[model samples]
Target: MASYDLPRRLVAEAFGTATLVATVVGSGIMATSLTADTGLALLGNTLATGAMLVVLITVLGPVSGAHFNPAVSLVFAMSRSLPKRDFGGYVLAQTVGGVAGTIAAHLMFALPLLEVSTKVRTGGAQWFSEGLATFGLVAVILAGIRFEQKAVPWLVGLYITAAYWFTASTSFANPAVALARSLTDTFSGIRPIDLFGFWLAEISGAVAALLLFTWLLQPGTSSTLSSEAKL
Candidate 1:
């Protein structure tokens, strides 16, 4: 809202997006580098990622409203936390920052990125898995901002960890990360062709939350998350 706040928001978005891509790519590389049995690597990455998400949300959430996902930003606007005019700015920052984050990750690892998912090769249970994973994540976030105000940031991380562990799709919830991960043809890559299917599932999940969160989640204050404000 303030003139100074816009730049701060942009910086937060950049930093947060960078952190996300770095964690995914760095962990993916480290995991791949650690021999055949990558279960431990995956576990470590999962925890680190979850923790980073919490930290990022806590630090940047207040500043940027932490709409790290474009879909999240959209839903937030629909839910009225964000101004409609600012939506385009947020989306632009997110998209550019996300792509920049991916490029940074790729450069950091010195890995080759193949145009992997360009032919619609992904199908079957993968789509469903994406849907479920995304829905679970959005549900967690909405619950936080809607009812559990103080718990929102940290819980975001924990929710991510659980999603990775329980969901078939390893819970790549943020579309920013999804696009960034596509840059690297590694354990994280979903082939350029496969991207559409996963994106469709994720978008569906976000929209579902937008439509249903008001009824499903407990009400919260306009400023603080509680049952005080009547929106």
Candidate 2:
């Protein structure tokens, strides 16, 4: 692993997360303004978010492993890929960056800077969808890192793009992203009251993926996983 200081890595995580959320919120706003068709708006948002993921991960992965999502960071920590001591910093950075991204998108669209979302996304189906979506996301990430390290960016981008449509909650598989989205009353937002279900589901999915992959990829091994194993 190429040595980089913790501060630099944290900065990269923050910057990358901010850009990712901006891409999601900004594109959703743009899509809604341009079309009345729900499917078309979703398609536009999905494409923009996916494209941004590819670019951001490619550019920032070397710096911080590009963990813009808290769920991903937690998975890495549990798998011993991310240092336990640095876990809190990663989560904090991602949370703050996510909020900043929401604010940026709101300012760009001339909307209220901190509107609470009224979009009520709840129910058992929605929770199940979130779990399924996050499960696939973590699964793909771990598998790609282990096998096709060079293609992780593209793999993640494509998986997210597909998951957006397949999942009921539009695949808010990221905890930070989901929390930030609640601050925007836009097409991609989720109600604050519904946050618990989403977070629980996402975390559960990520943990499940981590355990499964650990068993499959390195059965009976206890060595600490390297943070720069592949990313």
Candidate 3:
């Protein structure tokens, strides 16, 4: 991997996250504008978000491990793949970039730059779906990095694409993205009041994956730990 300083990595994380959230919010707006079918609009949003993940991760992975999601960063921090000192920076950049992404999307769509979302997305099922979605996401990321480093981007993009269809909450597996989405009152938005459940579930799910994969990927010999992934 290329050696980049902390500032560069933060910039990459922010930029990648901004682009990702932009794609998500922008596509949702466009889809709803063009269609009345909810499913079709969701399909459009999913495709754009998935495709952008592939592109963003492919280009920025070397710079910042393409950790556009705070949940992903948290997992890396817990697993010791990411330095403790850098974890806060990563989360800050992701959150700031995510909000900027919402503003950018709103600008393009001629909507308010910031608004409280009225979309009601809450309940036991939704929270559970968020947890399960994030668990699978972190699991895939860890396994991909361990077994196939070069395929991490594609693996993540594809996993999210599938998760979007399989999960009840449409797989808002990313905390930063979820927060950004709440700033928009569009089709992709979630109610701001519902953020706590999503955040709790996402963080818990990521930690769970880390604990499971740490053991699952451990080498047979007790003398050695599981292979360390840089990202």
**Pairs that collide, model 2:** none
lDDT of 3 by residue, 89-195 (tens): 99999999999999999999999899899999999999999999999999999999999999999999999999999999999999999999999999999999999
Prediction RMSDs, each to the true structure = 5.6, 6.5, 5.3
Better of 2 and 3 by TM-score: 3
- For candidate 2, the per-residue lDDT at 169 reads 86
lDDT by residue (117-148, candidate 2, tens digit) is 99999999999999999999999999999999
**lDDT, each prediction:** 0.74, 0.93, 0.93
Model 3's alpha-carbon lDDT is 0.93
Runs of candidate 1 with Cα error greater than 4 angstroms are 1-4, 112-121, 218-231
lDDT of model 1 at position 75: 77
Q: Which stretches of candidate 3 lie over 4 Å from their true place?
A: 221-231
> What is the clash count for each candidate, in the order shown?
9, 0, 0
lDDT of candidate 2 vs native? 0.93
Best by TM-score: 3
Minimum summed lDDT over a 10-residue window in model 1 is located at 112-121
lDDT of 1 by residue, 1-231 (tens): 243478788777777887777777677677868856767777877887888888888888878977678777877788777888778888778867776766776777775533343323366677777777777777778887667888988888888888887876787766767777776666666566567777888888887866777676655555664444544
